[model samples]
Target: MILAVDVGGTNIRTALIASHGGTVQELRSRVSLGDRGVSENDLIEKLSALFSEIISSHNDISAIGIGFPGFFSAGSGILLSSPNLPQLHNVDLAGRLSEAVSLPVSMQNDALCAAIGEHRFGAGKGHANLLHITLGTGIGGGLILNGVPYTGESGMAMEFGHLRVAGSDLPRSCGCGGSGCVEAYASATAVSAQYFERSGIQTDAGDIYERACKGDKHAKEIIESAGHCLGMAIAQAIKLLDIHTVTISGGFAGAWPLLHPAIIKSLDTELIPPLKGKTTVLRSTLDDTAGLLGAAALIN
Candidate 1:
């Protein structure tokens, strides 16, 4: 048995999964992150409580898995550049959590973990070439080539969201400091910002989709633009990597119906002949449970 955890800036989800690869069972858990009104100790406490409960109920668990939302140095099990999680940078999250629970633990970048999960157990189950693009607060991704997760030399390649758009009004001011990157236009945050800028209505990603369904023109426009931006990136990715499958996950993907056409149109214009209609883009089969389940894969 393995305990897979998806720890994010706002929420943390944990689940128990079979060690060998089968159906993953989600465990009930949640923790508010950051230091605004919460302390790191409180965060630790929540984890400790959950761990204790799990162990008490199922002492057969042998290890723990963590899908961390940040740059991870697997050699050290420490978090790096965890922008969303201000309290986690340079912290030995895996070590601390392992000590608290008395279990062996491993961690990976959440996006990379998702890619592995998709390739090994989800949509790209039988594919050797796979890419998992997460379209939530930011457009992040993980790549798999020849059935292996490929993180560049320094463990941070395929930062797909950072790819720049040739000519655009928007410039990326992401933590990485790039310009007109795909994330600035395709991300859920970006869509909401566009909507807010146009209609002066601040809304979450879900609300953006909801409003669009109700015929809010501004909301509809923002999401469509985001889709186009994503499609352009997808087209480029296909041209360069020739991956067989691309899975869109995260919040914005939920708004896919509003964004799919634009993405298809954008990809149609730039695609190469051999890859024109070869790549398969689809939604994630795993739900909120994907990250947690993916995290669990590290232990295997």
Candidate 2:
């Protein structure tokens, strides 16, 4: 068995999987990193405690795989930058964990790991070219070309959310110090922020979705706008890569009903005649475990 860990801003999810493919067990632990004083050592200790618990329960585990968000040296497993987990910047996560656990550890960008898992076992299975877009706190993505995950030189090519696709009317600033990026409009954070900006009500994306489901026009419009921005970005990606298979995942994607129409409409409007209607966009089939399973794929 292999242990797979997906580190997120809000929670850390871990799982045990058969080396071949498939989850055998899973667990979720809320992360407490919002405190300003939290340090890298604190994060490391929390993760170490979780790993120890997993190792104790599963003695047959042979390797460890981690799906970490943000900028990282994939070859060295050294996190270079983490906007969400700022305390972990420059931390050698895989090296430290391997030393503490006495096991081989491999790591990759969380979005890339999700792409691998989706391509191998979920929505993108059997496709030669795939794009996995994650719509969470921020929009992120991974590219699979010719059935292989493609990370550019030094492993930082697929920062799709930072792609500038927003117009002046919706030019919200991003954490990356950019304005008018896709993430500024399409992320869950953006969804809520947009709603609050217009309606003067502050709530999470899920609540906005729930309100939209109950026939709230304002809430529905905000979600559609987000979809339109996301569609614009995806259309650009399709035009550039010529990849037809795209999978959308993340907690916010649960509102697919509201987002799908705008995405498809924008795609139809933007794609060229030969490419129009050729792309196949799908919601992820792996639920929320794609990251975990994808991480496991790295070591397997």
Candidate 3:
């Protein structure tokens, strides 16, 4: 069995996966160390305790895998920076976790891990080259090129959310401290904010999606705008990588009924002539399990 950890901006989820059959046994979910003013030592101790708790119950665990949200040295597992968790910097998270748990630990970008999970077991199965986009509190992207995960030379290749999709005149502030980024326009957070801005109502993205389904014009417009911006970003990525298959996952993806049409419309309008109808967008079958499965797959 491999212990898989998925560290997100809002939550930390862990699971045990059978190496052969890919069966997953989720342990529990915990609140993540996000903007809580926790120190690096505190973060390590918390993670160690969490792993130890799981290890005590499951003795078959042979290794540990982590899907972390941050910029890291892919080869060394040394985290250089994390936009969400600003406290972690230049830390050897994988090595320290391995020492604490006495098991080999492999770590990579959380979105990239999700891409790997999709490629191996979900909607991306059978696709050698594809793009995986995660639309949650923030937008994230990953790439599979020629049957291999591509993280680029600096391990920061597919920062799709940060892509400049909107013009400077229509600036939308992003969490990454940038304006006019695709993330600022298309993320779940952005969806909620945009709805609130339009209707003077404050609600979560899911509620907004539900409202859209129930024939709320404001909600529909907000979701449609978000989907269009997302499609524009995907178009730019496709132009660069020439990858036609794109898979989307995460909480906001539940609004596919509304997002699909807008995304396809934007793609048709923006994509170059030769690539007009070649793109295929798929919804994830693994849902939230993709990250955990991908993390465990790192062990093999």
Give all candidates' CA lDDT scores: 0.78, 0.85, 0.88
Could you tell me how far off, in angstroms, the CA of residue 27 lies in candidate 2 after the best superposition?
2.6
The TM-score-based order of candidates, best leading, equals: 3, 2, 1
Model 2 TM-score is 0.92
Q: What TM-score goes with each of the models?
A: 0.87, 0.92, 0.96
Query: Model 2 over residues 1-300: C-alpha lDDT tens digits?
Result: 999988877677788888888754885554443454567777667777778888888899899998987666756788776767666677788888888888898888999999998998899999999999988998889999998788887678688998888456747888889799989888999999988988899999999999999998889998998888888899899889999899999989988998999899988987889999999889999968888889999984
The best candidate by TM-score is: 3
Local lDDT at 176 for model 3 = 76
Clashes of 1: 1
**Candidate number with the higher TM-score (1 or 3):** 3
lDDT for 51 in candidate 1 is 78
lDDT per residue, candidate 3, 51-105, as tens digits?
A: 9888998899999989998877866778887776777789999999889989899
Worst 10 residues of 3 by lDDT: 29-38
Which parts of model 1 have CA positions greater than 4 angstroms off?
36-50, 74-80, 85-96, 170-172
* Backbone clashes, each candidate: 1, 0, 0
Q: Which stretches of candidate 2 lie over 4 Å from their true place?
A: 28-42, 85-91
